[model samples]
Target chain A: MTPRRILLGAAGAVVVVGVLEAVSRSGLVDETSLPPASTVLKEAGKLAVDREFLVDVGATVREWLLGLLLAVLAAVPLGVLLGSVPLLGTASRALVELCRPVPSVALIPLATLLFSSPAQTNMSLIFYACLWPILVNTLYALRDVDPVAKDTLRAFGSSTPAVLWRVSLPSAAPFIATGVRIAASVALVVLISTELLVGGDNGIGIYLTETQQGGGRTDLMLAGACWAGVLGLLANTALIALERVAFRWHAARVEGIA
Target chain B: MLEISGLGHAYGTHRVLEGIDLKVGEGELVTIVGPSGCGKSTLLRCIAGLVPPTEGKVVLKGAPIDGVPDDLAVVFQDYSRSLLPWLTVRDNVALPLRRRGLGKAERRAQAVKALASVGLEDAAGKYPWQLSGGMQQRVSIARALAYKPTLMLMDEPFGSVDAQTREDLEDLVLQVHRAEGMTILLVTHDIDESVYLGDRVVVLARNPGRVRDELPVTLPAGRDQIGTRADAEFVRLRAEVGRLVRGVVKDSEPPDATDAEDADAEAVATAVEEPAKK
Candidate 1:
């Protein structure tokens, strides 16, 4: 990215915020419903130093990270197995197709009733949401592994496990990384949604629920949502940067394709 | 030494190669040349045990090869796909050295030597994708060299590079073949390449791929691209291999169509389930 691009991005963000601030201040809408951007930003600043808010942020991040990690652990190996074995892949295709589209957010009530702990409920929902992207990406990436690389390894008398470890894994890694980045955002959304519905004690969603319950403090509610959005944005940016650095060759190849 | 006896292959109704028999001596470089889609690659795969021929068996030393032998290596033409893009050139070259029980330091040491042999010593740290197409192919060849296989198979290894790089790579293979005394079987569609690189050139006919003719190269060892190609004998041999590969010898050849059909029938008489695709 160039300095000029960064400058323009900053300017664009300021313009949006200015528009929101102006629209709110103009009294075109009731202040109680859509709090002025300045007032929300002021509350958000206080949130940066508030110990309780910090704990909420930490809890949200922890749940998101844990759920994503578990999903990746379960999905990647299972994806590789199904991807490599034609029989297993064919066997499970119907089941996967049926289960995949049922939204994890819709499962919140079921998960809340089934799991005793709030963490368990949050984790279950987040895990459900994060699994599909990672699994499908891993599966397709493994299938798309270069045949020549596999053949070259085989010609040297390398075993099946050797070829998988050396060729298939490396070839699939960039795709896997992209999947994880997508899963990270999905996990955050699911985590927050689960907490909001289940009424957790320490998460951004909990902060929103509590603020709304405490005589409808609309400023605090908007501020909490702002922090959550910022967190997602920062995470996505970092993950994108990491992908670029870790898989430069894959990045170059993708650019060439585009 | 390698012996292939009456080998035939088919994918359902699609017969790729049929009734092929050839013998290769130890430490000899043989090149197979023919038109496109002649199944020359399939023959190489069969010899390497990467793909099993439907009929007969390939015998390496005294044992019939049921799987790829430990003393075999292959250099494929599509270097962009053959070499792992994530690994450094040194690691790519050293990859086959694993399962040999060599320590990391030893593998790198051998890989460095192989890279130097191909004039890629300075590129050891770069990824295969970072190199030119020709340099990437050299990395593939360097990898095969580092494996130190008793037999090496190359499938049009220079096909995708520029002409100058192709010549350089051809020389690199010849240099390695002579230095290591490894038996090499190269498949090509280029007639001049077959005459230039092989100790003997085997021309194959398309459609039911089978050897049409074989000619021993009498050019002196240590050939150069300029000198050996200009040799009168080289000119004659290339033209001969070219004519044979182009199906020009079909008429003058003895009428063996019935014999070929009989052989094909016997080979497919006990047909069984098709083997899994490699």
Candidate 2:
């Protein structure tokens, strides 16, 4: 990002905060119902050092990471298998279409009953939610691999697996990285949603629920959500940085085309 | 050695090639020239064992072609797409060497040697996308050379480059052909390229493409673009091939001025129309 763009973004944020603060101070809504931006920002800052809130953040981040890792481990191979083998892709097309659209949140009650631990429940939901984006991206990326590149390897007498390793996998990697970034965001959302709905012992979602119970503290609830947004922003920025470093060749070629 | 007889192919109901018969001795460089839609590439693909012939068979070294042979390589027209962008030039060349049961170090050494042969050793550490179009094509050629295949197929290998680069690449092919002494079957639509680069030119006619004529190039082995292309024999052969390619000589009738025996040395050297300059 350029300095001017960053300055513009910060300016936009300041305007938003100013507008929210003005609306709250003018009594457009009761303070109890809609906390001022300054009060929420203050609570959010204090929660950064609060030990109890730190534990909740740790719980949420841990679940999100582990679930996302598992999804990557499972879904990438599955996508490659299906993408490389047309017969398998055709055989499973209907099944994939059937399962992909069912919302993971709708499975919360079933997951709570199935898993003995709340952590397991949260992880399963997050894993399910994160799987599709990574899998679909991998599938399409493999489809988009240059046919001439594959044929060049084949004409050199390279076997199928070698072609996959040397050509298709590397060609698909940038798209797969994109999928992982999307999945990271999805995983965090699912983790928080599960914790809120299932009432986990320690999580950002659980803390928000407790704030609601304790006299409906709008400031604390908003602060907890603000931290969630910051976590997502941090994760996205880190993943983008990783992609830029790892897929520099992809970036250069894309720039050349543009 | 390679032998193809009665080879034909069709996509569904659209027949692209039919009743083709050709042979190439070991260490021979043969080029196939045809007009567009003549299935020249399809013929190469059949010989490469990538697209199985719908009619007949290809036999290489006494073994019938099945899948892609164990000792074969192809340089495609679209070099940018043929070379992997993710790998550096050296690694792209080295990747095919793994099929030869070579270790990583051996592969790297062989890849570097091949790149050096193409005068691209300095580009070995750079990604394919980092190089210019001609350099990328050289990388693809280097990849093919690194494999040390018994048979190399090229489908319009220089079709994408500019005229200057194309001439340079043609000389490079001649140099490598002399050094390697491997069998090569190249397909192209450029009639001049066919006569300039081939030991023998096989011309094909379109509409269910089939072989129309084969002319042995009598040009000297050590050829330069300017001197060889301007030679009298080169001019005569090019005109004849152009006429054959354009269907000027009817399929049933033969040109009366030329005979098959001692034709290169004593064919009608005079009264031949010069081919239009490019």
Clashes of each: 0, 0
lDDT of 2 by residue, A1-258 (tens): 999999999999999999999999999989888889999999999999999999999999999999999999989999999999999988988988888888899999999999999999999998898889998899889989988789888888877898999899999999999999999998888888889889969999999999989468999999999999999999999999999999999999999999
Report the lDDT of model 2 for residue A54. Answer: 100
Residue A128 CA error for candidate 1 (Å)? 1.1
TM-score of chain B for predicted candidate 1: 0.88
DockQ of each: 0.66, 0.68
Worst 10 residues of 2 chain B by lDDT: B265-274
| Pairs of colliding residues, candidate 1 | none
lDDT of 1 at A193: 81
DockQ for model 2 equals: 0.68
Off by over 4 Å in 1: A256-258, B248-278
lDDT of 1 by residue, B33-132 (tens): 8755567778888998988889988999878999899888889877888988888999999989986889999999999999999999999999887889
Evaluate candidate 1 and give its CAPRI docking class based on DockQ.
Answer: medium
For all predicted structures, in order, the TM-scores are 0.92, 0.92
